[model samples]
Target: MAQPAARTGPGPRRAQDIFAATFALLTELGYDGLTVEGVAARSGVNKTTIYRWWPSKDALLGAALIDSRLFELTVPDTGTLRDDLHALLDQMRKLLTGEEAGAVVAAVLSAATHRAELAEVTRSFFLDRLGRELPLFERARRRGEIRAGLDPKTVIDLLAGALWVRVLLRGEAAPAGFVRETVDLVLRGVAA
Candidate 1:
């Protein structure tokens, strides 16, 4: 939940510095106006070094996101689907509200529309993360906490889609209790 520290010079910690710089630039210039030259200037890393690591600006941003650990998730096993989902949602709330990470997510999502590479990067990142959580849904189905017919993908989309609506489109933090309410609704519909 802590913001990454920006690097003043390149070394073993160069990537973190670049990532910090990238997020800072994203907040300042947005996706469209951001440039590798700008990032290099800010991070004190050479542009060629960045290019060696990432092929494009979008790729660099995606690497920065991964390096930030903002997208990392661990599905909880709390003996019931409802409890599990609440934990997952709560973690997601942190990712959305935490410094640097939230702004990076917003910038990437905003850029995905007109930038194909960025769209792919964003989609791939989410899909990969969701895949990691699928076993939770499978476990719930086996335990009959959720209906057997429910698709895990649909459930993931619903949960994450609602988050995107609140965080990205609405430009508001989800109201207090929104996570619990949303989990309850999804559970009611999918519960056995």
Candidate 2:
């Protein structure tokens, strides 16, 4: 007797459905309450299907974050460091303040603290984002837009840290014109 053909994995449509389900669950259940079974049920997919693509909830959530454009941190190249900084910072500010994103962001941040593996994944995600932006700083330095001795890592830490504390810890909306002010302050410290 001939054996059945091997099973192929999810295609693009199925992946989108899975991601949509993941986001919906994140918004409804929050991170702690979310599970693979829940996503499978919501997506009308099987648990094995999700498992084939993502090994764990953390992995699933990370992929959903990327796929849904929730982690959309594209570094801008506007020909000037100030302009680029404003663009990037404003993107971050909008992400943090957007109503649709608040629950998901809060869930992810809370999960990072409660789950060690998730925390590591979150750390890696942030490091990768920072790495992607390093070239922006490098370009600015090469063009004499910023000081020669500037460090990308330090700059990112200062900027990201301030935002993290303002939104997460203090639970305060970043003040009006916060993104512009942040860019100007950081530029003043680093401009050539």
Best by TM-score: 2
Put down candidate 1 lDDT per residue, 1-192, tens digits, no spaces.
998976443454777888888888988999877899999999998999888778789988877765555466778999888888888988887788776678778788878899899888887787777777888888888887876678888887888778778977887887538888998888788878
Task: Give per-residue CA lDDT, model 2, range 1-192, as digits (tens).
Answer: 999977665777887788778877888888877899999999999999799879999898777776666557779999988888778877887788777676677878887888888887677777778878888888888898877777888877877677777886888998648777877887788778
Off by over 4 Å in 2: 1-13
- Measured against the true structure, the TM-scores of the candidates, in listed sequence, are 0.83, 0.86
When summed lDDT is taken over every stretch of 10 residues in candidate 1, the lowest stretch is 5-14
Winning candidate number (lDDT): 1
Candidate 1 residue 50 Cα shift, in angstroms, is 1.4
- Per-residue error (Å), model 2, residue 133: 1.3
